[model samples]
Target: MQVLFITGQNQYGVVSHFLDGMREDLESVGVRTDSLSVESEQHIHRDLPQLLPLQEYDQLISFNGMGLHLEQAELSVPQYLKQRPVWVFCVDHPMHILKRIIGLNVILLCVDEEHVSFAQLCGFNARLFPHAIGKQQLANTSMMPLEDKSNEVVFPVSYMDSGSHRQALTPYWSQIGHWVEQSRSVTRFMQFIGVLPIGNRPASLTLNEQILRLCVTVDSYLRAKQREACLHFFAQQNVNLTVIGRNSHCYQSIAPTHQYLNAMDFTDLQQKIAAARYVVHNSPGFERGLHERVIYPLALGTLVLTFETPYVNQTFPQVCLDAKQSSGQISDKEYQQRRKQAHQQIEQQHCWHHQLRKLFTSPTTSPDSNGRTR
Candidate 1:
């Protein structure tokens, strides 16, 4: 099989790393792969035609719908893309890219189960494709003894302050809060937003579209709040905390006592994880999915302290530390056992090769179905 990856610029430059890893893994399995780098929307119109006048590959894969948004006037581009199956691997919430992907003949491979449900609700074909640890990440990491690790806690995430989002979204907070309280899950919140009349809907968007946009905004705000809360909780305990990512200065106000460093590429981030005693993962919106952040640290022999989510509790109950609980209570022997179990599980089930096999072999689901593969 042959696959063409639609690559593009991302803020943190992690997407390129992911594509490179996937390419290596796919080739190892006898799948030929190519990539097209799109710098902007204009590049898509200009460069995509190069693939036209002939069918070249079995599949066209993109992350977060990067190069698939073809304009209606660009008949050739859309026609060319439609000839081959298009797959979008959504690493974040699907709602954020709903507008860009509306008319494309693309199947969504979501990292989270809730994301699949959200995409299906929006009338798209989606499947549950959980995040996995790349082979390169594993190859670069060496398990450090817990006592020998340098940092006590490391959080490698891009920071977004919730206060700004909260103030901007204040007008719709009461209604959004009410909907959130009634419907605890993101999928259900979207259902309510679709049917209920939102008086504060934006003038530019249709009712459903406007409400859905609000839901995305609200989700972002909540996620930011949750991250901030987690950071503050750790700082209050006076643990040796280190924050690494963009907007490191934001930590000054949020948690001044903690050490902060600007963002680095995925390669450097792996080094940081391999040295840390514990990695804190704050996944606020992903209730039924595991983030690569959670998996990478565990695979690197660093215990993960994250919020209690259904997927984490069920999959890595031995390794995950509930953000609400004290990590100091766990004995050294227990920690070693948990780390061993977590590493084995990731090696056995959550590696890139495992995901690639599932991606190629699994049957696609109907758009009307429940959007789950496992």
Candidate 2:
């Protein structure tokens, strides 16, 4: 069946953009798909309220930022779905999903057992579709070593609101960050390896970070007498952090363990993230559930260092750490073990082969089955 990814990549579509790239992975496995970005094509604007690009899609996969106006706006989610069976994918906060569910046919979820308990309280069909790191680099472990890398660490920045980001991990950021700080020395990372940076500001209210800079200078200002101590420690250690994706956010003042590299396309971002020593991710917000940013790190076979989130615990339990307190800890051996486990799990459960298997084996597509959408 043909699937249409009806989405917006502008002002309101920041987080929504996370789920759109799955189309590439899906297509690699034989799924016919088209991604309709609200901010890209001129026709989308000319179509005026009628965003339907190519004709008849067997299914329309709606991301967040879709339906609140999903059904109301011009060339919006709701308008496109009315013509066919639309599955409202909800990996975001329950409140948003609940709002979109008002007239949607189905509420698709990327939930885990831990979160499902919470989902029950919100009263939506929060199911566990799980997320894959899009299969592109599931086995690309041949990464290059850095030169004179003082710190063998990687901290990719997120565009999430600084306040919401810290709040989500208030339960565990320091503890996790600290352990990561202590986990490696000069030998392990040899040099810090940061990954893709997005445009700070797009030409429009879009995802291009072409014009953004780090809030405080990324240099000494990044580590003052009383900021997150873990970050300060890295700076103090003279770490060599290589910023990727090349956003204008000049952390240049921070004297990051290293220099920023040239920009990369999204696919290269996946490859580089997979090659890094480790990636540090903040947890999802209270209202927003698991975000897809976390998975790419895991898929890359890079050990993940982030505030623990329920989704990660359920999917790649062995390949990560959940640092719950400012000073809590987990072992280097444990970290290593979990990292290996994450790699194995991705190969088994998260590869594109598995994705294709699920599609063909699902109720309607199964050989012995009657036609029905799961």
Which candidate wins on lDDT?
Answer: 1
| Top candidate when judged by TM-score against the true structure | 1
lDDT, residue 299, candidate 2: 53
All candidates' TM-scores? Answer: 0.83, 0.54
**Clash count, one per candidate:** 0, 28
lDDT of 1 by residue, 145-204 (tens): 878877558888778877787776778778677775465445556656564223454223
RMSD values for the candidates in order, in angstroms, are: 5.1, 13.1
Question: What are the lDDT scores of the predictions, listed in order?
Answer: 0.73, 0.45
Least lDDT summed over 10 consecutive residues: which range in candidate 2?
A: 186-195
What is the TM-score (0 to 1) of candidate 1?
Answer: 0.83
Q: What is the lDDT of residue 188 in candidate 1?
A: 54
